[model samples]
Target chain A: MLDTLDLKLLEEVADLHGLPQGAYNIRKNGQAADRKTTANIDIITKKDKPGIDIVVKPGTKEESVHIPVILSQSIGDLVYNTFEIGAYADVLIVAGCGIHNPSSEKAQHDGIHEFFVRKGARMKYIEKHYGEGEGTGQRILNPKTIIEVEEDGIVEIEMIQIKGVDHTVRDTEVRLQKNARLIVSERLLTNLEQTAISNITVELLGDESTAQIISRSVAQDNSHQDFHLNMYGYSKCRGHIQCDSIIMDQAHVTSSPMISALNTDAQLIHEAAIGKIASEQLIKLMSMGLTEDEAEAAILKGFLK
Target chain B: MLDTLDLKLLEEVADLHGLPQGAYNIRKNGQAADRKTTANIDIITKKDKPGIDIVVKPGTKEESVHIPVILSQSIGDLVYNTFEIGAYADVLIVAGCGIHNPSSEKAQHDGIHEFFVRKGARMKYIEKHYGEGEGTGQRILNPKTIIEVEEDGIVEIEMIQIKGVDHTVRDTEVRLQKNARLIVSERLLTNLEQTAISNITVELLGDESTAQIISRSVAQDNSHQDFHLNMYGYSKCRGHIQCDSIIMDQAHVTSSPMISALNTDAQLIHEAAIGKIASEQLIKLMSMGLTEDEAEAAILKGFLK
Candidate 1:
């Protein structure tokens, strides 16, 4: 069964006009309704893929579940295929390795869109890429997600790359109807190699629609990273993209966020900074007898803080 | 005669107790010897020629007065070379530059170094390099400065560049005595194809001495810039080097801040970053009825702020 928090999130999505009428329908399979708008899958461990495989109506609110375990550091590209977001269901929970697909470039686009379409739901998914073992490869695992939305829906998506991951790339695309909205937030931790390019594109088809993308990245050592964002605002929709990166050591970071306003009043702002730990600060700390590692850690903490 | 402010700053330099001594002296021409420890000299500024040309005794205090009506931008560096700070006197002053340098590079570095070598003086200098005309190829006017400090003296220097400017380069070198201290700071703002490279080297010959270098540069358009800071921390002296640069559009920036911490406990830190404007933020601002130029200006102001 669905929990209260998940229910609340679904309600919010529905209330936000993120779904269209008749987008979702109830269906049954065997002794159980194969897709229950109310029932939530308990868990989908690798030992037992016991979680419910959902089929969403065009525009129904779906259950939200937390998948804590699906992270493989070595995977280069993971494509989400075969999952469709229906017009009725407005939410999708990618609990485990949401998009940390190493090989399948179309995993999220193909796998995830299939479920959304079957469920008839406008999708809002949170993909967490977890890592195990000593992560190698300049290419961290990436989960590529694609969404095809009907008219008048919304999608709020977030991707957070925790520490200990090698590198990560997030490529997401959204096709929105009139008055549709998409919000994407991405957070990147330290320890990734260069070439961590995160690309996001939101295309507004409907009039007065909107999209916003926010990205934050922290780089240390010889890491090289880039954040590329493109928002195409058509039909008089408004769009925004913002990226911030903190560089430490010889780490190299580049951010190029672009917006194309095909129609009048289609609006966009970008800002970036590069700085080093102040030396007076280091001397002040070293004067206190803290080791070099301690001093570096303190500065990093202070910078993030 | 040396004023109270000048004397106080000199005292601060002398108090460091860890720099090459006798390298800095003050002499006053045509003045009777007196009990005052300050050296004050009188010199006539010949038209189109440097006013103070003189020498100093080893380990002695000398002073000379030269009031040149030069551009404000050219004062510091010119002052540096005129007195040969590294070879002789530590302090030089050109009463004031009543004229502004306008867009001339030769004018800016004219008298930058005179007050820099004063015993134990650590100071910050901020320069605004904006002009109405197009920026030139030669942005920084070189001013020679020579300094041999006594044991246990200290110096800290900083230069911040803001507004639009052309190419610039300044060469600086320092040799420290036992237990001396020295710090240097450089900041650059370049738009278009401007290129500026500052070459600085500090040799720490005495034990227990210290030197630090800090620099920041911002490049825009097709501009290219570089920084090279080399420090040799001989004996038990400490050396620290840090440099950072931010590039936008097709801009390119590089930094090579190297430090040879010959003794244990010597340390160095360096960092750099390059990124373009965020698209989402621009869209957001544009949605607020701001033009693209206004949005960019706002972001730049906020970033520097």
Candidate 2:
């Protein structure tokens, strides 16, 4: 059952203003609380574990699927979800997890998700990690996303973790086949001694394949973050990886991005930036009547947006 | 004779409102236009070349010196300049060059400047490069800056090149001794098929030495830019280098930064980012009643600022 706090969290993470339409699965307190299956999509619970297998037919189109998890008590939860998208199918998959810990104990969530996008299919995946509590309990989330794109498949991913996660380690690996394309955009924020680590590796293994990975993050009040991204371009492909972080109030950030190209026609580039807020930005906002703090917050909001 | 165009170029490069008061030298069209020396600062013209040796007294303070070069006609100019700051002296030096070529011939300026900041002294150096004309001839500038800081010395450098120049090559090298500190900030802009290349190297050779190099650049309209920076911490020291660039309208930017730390206590970091303007920034400005073009210009201006 979803309470007021649970509803607010669902809204915060997945924009589930009400119950999601089409096919959906809601997991709460380490168990599935609700589920639905549409005509074109099938959700099968894993017999051996605490997860599900989502399957879409070859001609499925314009369908929205939501699989969100929420925890309101101090506990440790793990799940393995697999997605099989058939050829020529187009769908949006929304999977976000939120945890609340009000006790002295810790609340953690670990999820491993694997997606297989079939030939000529287009998939858009959005995942958000969120934490909320009243007491001093630490909230943690670790997510691993593994994806394989078949020939001519297209995928766009958005991963966001912007508040109240005391610690997290996000791992992602992706492989692209011939003529496939991928775009992954990620954002994160940490403050008050929180720590976040991200490791991502993408390989363009077929000709004419391309991938772009972009990340933006901010650390404040002694928080620390590390970003490691590796991109490989082979067989007349192209890839790019970029990382940008803003460090404030003694916070530290480390960014290391590597790019390798095997074929002579393959092109790859990597870029990273770590710095504090620009004083001119503050001045410009102040001239428009906002205080320094307000200006900095506005700038950071725009940065993450 | 300093014509109106020459005076405008002077103001654009060095902020020269009138004849400089304390110590000044103005070079116009491959010849010296004016020269002046104050009580504590001596400008010695080199007998064998078209350059000068600047010597500052041991205790000179709160004074400014200006050296400006203006090329109104198509010509090639080369000069070698040196600075000798006595022990415990603190001063500011401004050196800027502007070229105007309204003919069918190439115009170029090559300058090599070397500085020695003695023990316990401090120096502030600023240089700007600009070009303007209405001709097909090329406007090119090549500058080299070399500096050495003795024990307990401090040096701050500001180098800016914005607009007009068709081609440029900038080279800089610095060495720091025990307890010395160095900070160098550079900014550049290229447009309309222009090209710019910058190479810089720094060595922290003694205990407690620290150095920081920051560069911001923009390339637009088929322009090209390449930035290469290297920092070496050979002892118990710290060093940081950052390069940020905005690429627009088919432009290309390449940033390569390397940081090496040899000692166990040495701390070094390097960051670089090359991207287009953020859409959020544009929307933010557009929300404030500006058009898209106006918003983009504002963002670029703030970025360079």
Best by TM-score: 2
For model 1, residues B71-175, the per-residue Cα lDDT tens digits are: 323333344223323223334332222223333444343443433243443222222333222333233434333445556666555444454345456666788
The CA lDDT of each predicted structure is 0.48, 0.86
| lDDT (tens digit, per residue) of candidate 2 on B22-128 | 89989998899989999999999889987889999887887878999999989999999999988889999999999999987989999999999999889999999
Candidate 2 backbone collisions, by pair: none
Q: Candidate 2: where is the Cα deviation over 4 Å?
A: B1-305
Off by over 4 Å in 1: A1-54, A58-62, A65-79, A95-122, A135-139, A192-194, A274-305, B1-305
- What are the per-residue Cα lDDT tens digits for candidate 2 across A1-305? 78898898898789998799889999998999899999999999999998999998987999988999998888999999999999999999999998888887999999999999999999999999898899798999999999999999999999999888999999999999999999999999999989999989898898999999899988888787878787766566778877777777766666656554444445666666665677889999999999889999999999999
Model 1: how far residue B7 lies from native, Å = 61
TM-score of each: 0.39, 0.57
Worst 10-residue lDDT window, candidate 1 chain A: A25-34
| Tens digit of per-residue lDDT, candidate 1, span A225-272 | 666576665565666666655556556554545444444344432333
DockQ of each: 0.02, 0.04
Docking class of 2: incorrect
